[model samples]
Target: MITAIVHIDVEADRIPEVAAQVAELPGVTEAYSTTGDVDIIAVVRVAQHDMLADVIADRVSKVSGVVRTRTYIAFQAYSQHDLEAAFALGLDD
Candidate 1:
């Protein structure tokens, strides 16, 4: 799966409305109203890279009250348990 973090900016009065709309999009897993430079953060998962444009450009950007968006693609993930799991699986300490 291809995962992306989309930071969304929306009309000040439409944060909740825009977040709800974005969350309903096919590829979006979740959307949150956040406190920071961006108003909302959306997690999007797609089967292919090209689908990103379809979900973000062709759809998300057109949502009513959405001002703009910035997308960041994830390359890897690390967690506290990853090391423990690797060790248990026989990785040499």
Candidate 2:
């Protein structure tokens, strides 16, 4: 699986709406409104590298109120145990 951490910038008042839309996308595992340089952060999982672009362009970019996005694709994962722990905690849906 290819994992992506997408940082999204949206209009302040539209943060919740944008986050809800993003979270409903097929490849998006989680989306949260945050207080930082970016308004929302989304985690996406794609079966292939090529599919990542589709998820970003078709799903993420199409969300209303989203101004911009920066996608960070994970290169090397360190520990499966950490991932498992996160899942066990119900962090990733």
Candidate 3:
């Protein structure tokens, strides 16, 4: 599986609508409105890397208020609780 974190820039007032659209896409596991350089953050999981671009172009970018996007591919991920447990045992080092 491939995981992508997509940062979306949308019209300020339309963030909620855009976020709702993002959440409905097939590959999107989660989407949320956030404060930063981008107005929304979406998590996309796909069966192949090439499909990632298709999801971004066909689904995410097609949303009414979306203006731009920056995608980050995740190499590894850990829950905060796992990280804390590892740190407490000095396993992270």
Clashes of each: 0, 0, 0
Candidate 3: the clashing residue pairs are none
lDDT of candidate 2 vs native? 0.91
Candidate 3, 1-93: lDDT as tens digits: 999999999999999989998999999999989876879999999999999979998889989999999899999887999788877895454
Error of 3 at 91 (Å): 19
Q: What lDDT does each candidate get?
A: 0.94, 0.91, 0.91
Residue-level lDDT tens digits of model 2 in 1-93: 999999999988899999999999999999988876989999999999999889998879988898899999999777989887867894555
User: For model 1, what is the alpha-carbon lDDT of residue 36?
Assistant: 80
TM-score of candidate 1 relative to the true fold:
0.85
Best by lDDT: 1
Q: What is the TM-score of each candidate against the true structure?
A: 0.85, 0.82, 0.82
Clashing residue pairs for model 1: none
Total clashes in model 2, counting residue pairs 3 or more apart in sequence or in different chains: 0
RMSD in angstroms between candidate 3 and the native structure over all alpha carbons: 4.4
Q: What is the lDDT of residue 4 in candidate 1?
A: 95
Indicate which candidate wins on TM-score: 1
